[model samples]
Target: MNFGFLKIAAAIPEIEVADCRHNTAEMEKLLREACQRGVSVIAFPELSVTGYTCGDLFGQPVLLAEAEKTFGELMERTADCPAVAVAGLPVAVDGRLYNAAAVFCRGKLLGIVPKTYLPNYNEYYEVRWFASGDELKTDTVTLCGQTVPVSSKLLFRSGEVCLGIELCEDLWVPVPPSSLQAVHGANVLVNLSASNEMVGKHDYLRDLVRQQSARTVSAYLYASAGCGESTTDVVFAGNGLIAENGVLLEEAERFVPGSRLVCCDIDIERLAALRRKTNTFAYAGPSPAFRSVAFDLPAYGRSYPLLRHYNPTPFVPSDDDGKHRRCEEIFDIQCTGLARRIRHTGARTAVIGISGGLDSTLALLVAVRTFDLLGLPRKRILGVTMPGFGTTDRTYDNAMGLMRALGVEIRETDIRAACLQHFADIGLEADDRSVTYENAQARERTQILMDLANRSGGMVVGTGDLSELALGWATYNGDHMSMYGVNCSIPKTLVRHLVGWIAATHADEATRPWLLDIIDTPISPELLPADERGDIAQRTEDLVGPYELHDFFLYHFMRFGVPPDKLFFIARHAFGERYAPETIKKWLVVFLRRFFAQQFKRSAMPDGPKVGSVSLSPRGDWRMPSDASAALWIAQAEAIRTDEP
Candidate 1:
């Protein structure tokens, strides 16, 4: 098994109450199937050997003995399966029986991790038939054909991954054993649960898994007992989930026997780097206060098809209902923020520059929304289309038409002569195309917009987005400075899709046709003149690659602090034949370099609404040094590019 990657699965197989033979046989089928599918680690539901709803049958001497015997047979059947399997049963230890996960691999029983907490309240009366790990006396027990360590402190170690397993009530306690297991050197966590379904309980379960993964910064695998159990008192609704860091990879439907097996290659190298970067994560290894066990898997060089979930558009909400909800909430945030600012400043009108581009279009829409909220005249929203040296007729015409149709005060101010005068004032040669040449035009436009706002007693709304801030793509004192930024938290990738949503659902046919056409247009600033082909020039992706890819890199790297090598691995799987490695590598290097260099810009950003979790606003999420070095990250990325995989 490769340490950098290993496939893990959380399976919720059908179970039979008080039927060890039937349950073990069914589990064996799923176990062998998972191995054939190339899963290296597989976890089944809690108490699957005898079932979670066994009630008084759990204490029956005949049932316990039969379960123990069947557990031994399961070990032999999955001997050469090549997957570490975890199944739960009750083991008699000292004077009490303990709820335990019997970990088996390579024709031998590795260990038994007992449940740390026994729930006695609500629908759970686990204390009736089980004892907590704290009450255990012996550390080793003889079962089957070998002597194995049976304790809650046991951590199973393979060459590829280090794992710790916990049971149902163990995770619900305030101090979960999983947290200590993570601190004692476990990189991946598994939970075998038999939690009963209740109204609104699924939400809490999801949040718990997400929080645990985030708290430990490790891959989490959780498998819950399914519907085929003794429902005499409470029903088991088969909840299963797989999460990495805090993002949910897959979640199973409750009460349905989908036999969920969610698999993803956990990035061990990235976990190591995150632990290295954060000083708070403590490592252990002096004394044996915590027990340890080690096992080796058979040769794990077998190839497995990619199983990681890929959200083609990670920024856009995937569910139709979720997308609608987010759009409505985002509109409200922008509208309320702008409305409050306008009211406090006593500005009766709002002025915005319109380029018919996605960013400005979004800003103008927000302005209209704010005016609508204030019960003011739609004509108070003044939109100006300023044609310049590189202005194209398509964008200019669309910009004018959109403004006129919105019933706003539409104005036109050709800035070609005004920009030339500004260039002379700055002693910059107009023929010499450089930052000065490009930024002079931007500052001139900003000046006109700002002056128009003052003349109309309105506020000039900003439109630069989150991606631009991360890349430092905005001109200083030009597009960078404004009274308020309406689309600051939205990424460039999402902006396109959000505007697409409007075109499809909100705008009329007249506006919808032009919006779709603009969506097809090449993403550009239109700063440079058109080519001899009479088409718009100055494509942005030609200089800075696709924003979609860069935003992916940004979300993973900046949000999770994932290492470059692992990030490269994930991208290779996610993008497959869509992009050449050289192209992805080129843009990855650009993203790293610009992300590090652009911190100074984000550190001084003006007040803006944080509608997403990965915002760079100083008061919110990200906090990085203005001059942090990218040398190590660049080196790692270059090494990946050079590696002969």
Candidate 2:
């Protein structure tokens, strides 16, 4: 279901230069098809009606009349279609001719936005034929027996969607009209271009579009002239792009044989939420000249299918190359931060607790890299493995093996004896296996790490990741408190990837196997006793819910401030096949409760580098009162009916 999503498309139709009738027919066919596919808005390339390569022919009054007539006919033919369509054509107002984009719905012209910038240099001479609309003396133009608003300041609004149009060179200008339009409340920016293909231009254009979308925090739709355009001087590859807030959702194949429509759904609600979250987005009030033109579109409810892809693991990159690059960058950030801290404090050694789990393993790897970066001996980074009741042989053996392979000083301290003694002194039964029992082991391990660091004038590196921090899964004064946390902003889902990346790219043959084994080991605090088979008995997920789900909740909840219901809506779509809706709702409730209850932990979190957009560090990106209530959020989440599609 398309919950708060608007489906939009960019159409590249076969066109004959100056043959307005044929162009109109092709555009109509595509428009109808897009409407049938439930596209709420569709855009065509610049000057598509008469073809962009008409050159000086754009000056001919007969050709201009035909283009106008064909545009009217195209609208009339697609009157029954339920989509807002933007078509490009030449408009002559009084004695001046201007390149324009016409917005039409239900056979009616809503508005026309003229091209602001006329590119007069390089391989093109658009100034030779068309005057910049910026010079036009009038705000309205008469066409097809109707007066339509023709200005760069016009915005088309339909329900929750507000779109602003720009033609060709307008996007290339230093300050595109879209910038002001977005500030004036345009959530979607459409660009129509007849740009020619050249070496390295496509990538540049894509980057420009994506960056503009990001800067404005809106969806940017771009449709360029295609194969049918004149190749007398240059070639048009028919590039079409749809991007939302820096991400390119869909791109049409360049140089395809026939007509093509690139379609994707834009999350209008997400953009609005982001705009509300960032004060700078709307710092400048709406422009006085800008006008909003209203239009109508059929409501797309939950029954409509969502076309965009939502990464189940939002914290981790989806592709292998991206994952590797991200891991490398994160590793560098961690090392740089730790190295700076070490130099600043003049610490001689780096001490970390190795659990043979993802978070601890990642922390150890970062410490090793940090020591290497600072030109310190690897032996100076002490890897301490504190095994307790729940320490399985597999994890214990892997921890020892990894520490030895990495050339780090290894120290094993069985905390069972110390924890039992503490329980006896505290008047608690050793067999209780309650929070006290688990927390006793955790505090003992932290005390040992802190003492060892003190002995060598080293600092304690934290192993708790973002997931643990979000869910308050760490023991407050135990695994939670550290001198410095390298994985403070790294999520559990990403920790696995980072460790796996090390295994594949950075680790030597001797260390790769142990890293791989650690990556596969189930995450646990190892405070409880092991089962008969020596496997981990207290699986973290079994108690706290899956890290993947928790990480997803943390990202949307903290990063975008998405409320519980909407979070549930998107999460169901993201992990629908992998988990049941009831299960999602259950964990979402847990996440909200724990997230609010755990703010105290995050409020006092150790110093850590911010690697991504979402961070729980009190001194950084996120700041919240530890006493905030989750009652309202939990209520909204509880209202979600899993029976609904």
Candidate 3:
């Protein structure tokens, strides 16, 4: 029952203090607008009906009665649409007052989730007005002429997208019930918060939302109490955010006063697929306790455009200042990871094979950065260039230029003679430039670096990237082997941008120009011989698709666990004109075939830092069976393509 798409809306509706009628009207307006926008699930802030700051009026009999009357009318108003909405109101059950959120879908009251933690600290006395949900004795309750299930353990269902709800403080508790909800079956978490405004509070709130989404590997929708609420003692900032699998895609700045709704389609298929991939995540034994609440959401046709933000450089920050800050931070993660390894092992230096390619360039930069960080002289960092069969003048010049500019210890070793000797040593022909020839050169280069590291009393620094590992482009036990790979977790597309970022932000006027030229050079492993102009002859993209397309497919497919059909659906939308459908189809097949065939390389990969969510490190993020079949994926991809007329 995995639905292809989920339309979610984080609604910030207009409100008035203690004005239940005005609140109901505003809620209805937003609900209708959301329904028209094809939002299947809409969420409003906590205590939205009677206003969160009603104070002692929560116990007022007149106010309670009016709130119920307005809610009944609001339920009738939203009865026609398929979109289910959660509205906050003070509900009294068996003479006990509770700060609760009521859910309505398709004319029926689905369930009610009450606040579990009552605030009792300074400036906040929620204990005076509301009761915790743990105080509830039963699940069945009568609301607006029908019996609705009322409990904190409610999972409102719409096919494979199981949703769990919790009040604001409920999520903030040490042992949040939402944790159990996720362990059981809920894949989507909803939080209705009426948190008051305070300095340094938003940061905590943002982190809380991100961690919850990541912990569950689920989509999280947070609708905080926004504008129009009473600010008698505390103020509310209309903050709304929508996050999926830990990444914050959209967030509205607090204190903004408008009817704001951040709407995006959650890739339910992706979440479900990830759960399948992480087979051990089923810590909770299979149970039939989950109830499916049915609702018929509009299709919006097969292709619904994605409104979520797309990071062209997922590894590189979009903001200029932030990108520099991140470059500095990541430089630390790489150098720190390596420095600790070096210190623990008592290695005196770090040796890297610099090729002036993006991956090796980044590795060399990390080594220099690490030594600088450790107060070790640059000369302690050894850069060896073992040029072989496909040596290009551009790369050779760039490599020498960078080593000279950085003042690192440089060693020049020509691998042509050494590899040819090895070929002869192994009784192989040196003239043949096949996988053996290419890999022999790579292994020889690595051997040189490794011996150099040992001779220098240091460890070899690796430079193979995540994308290279995914495609198995690295020579197994050759370039793929390293003591600690600084670039292992970074992808190809991202590696290019990081080098560019360093050039723009850190490199000097002279050092920067050569770095830019190095980035502009074609991405080649340089296994094949050079052309007439002494340029690269073995371009990586010729065998694999463009790194950008593969990266896009990788994020949705591996990170979110989206299916091939939906993935192709998204690729069509994102890279429509840039790449023709036929071309995308061809590369997509290449990606699947290569990805499945090459997981063995990833299975035995060296130690590397994980920079992003989707990593292929067998010990870390991805742990797939090396022989897992790509037949299903390839078949689905084939179906997406219509044969030429």
RMSD of every prediction: 4.4, 1.8, 4.1
TM-score of predicted structure 1: 0.84
Q: Highest TM-score, which number?
A: 2
Query: What is candidate 1's CA lDDT for residue 216?
Result: 86
lDDT string for model 1 (477-499, tens) is 88886788888888899888878
Candidate 3's residue-wise lDDT over 248-364, tens digit each?
Answer: 867877778877787887777777777777787668555435444555555565444566555534555678887778777777788788888878888898889989899999999
The TM-score that candidate 3 achieves is 0.85
lDDT of each: 0.81, 0.89, 0.82
Best by lDDT: 2
The TM-scores of all predictions, comma-separated, are 0.84, 0.97, 0.85
Compared with the true structure, what per-residue lDDT tens digits does model 2 show for residues 1-645? 255689999999999999999998999988988877889999999999999989889988899999999888888888888889998999998788888899998888898888989988988788898888778788888888778898878999877789999987889989899999899889989999999899999999999999999999999999988978988889999999999999999999998878889999998888988999898887665455788899997665666677888888999888888887888899999989999999999999989999888888889999988888778999999999998989999999999999999999999899888888888999997469789998888899999999999999999999999999999999999899999999999999998988988888889999999999888888888888889888899889998899899988888888777888889888988987799999999999999999899999998889989899998889978888999988999999999999888
Ranking by lDDT: 2, 3, 1
Error of 1 at 350 (Å): 3.3
Candidate 1 pairs with clashing backbones: none
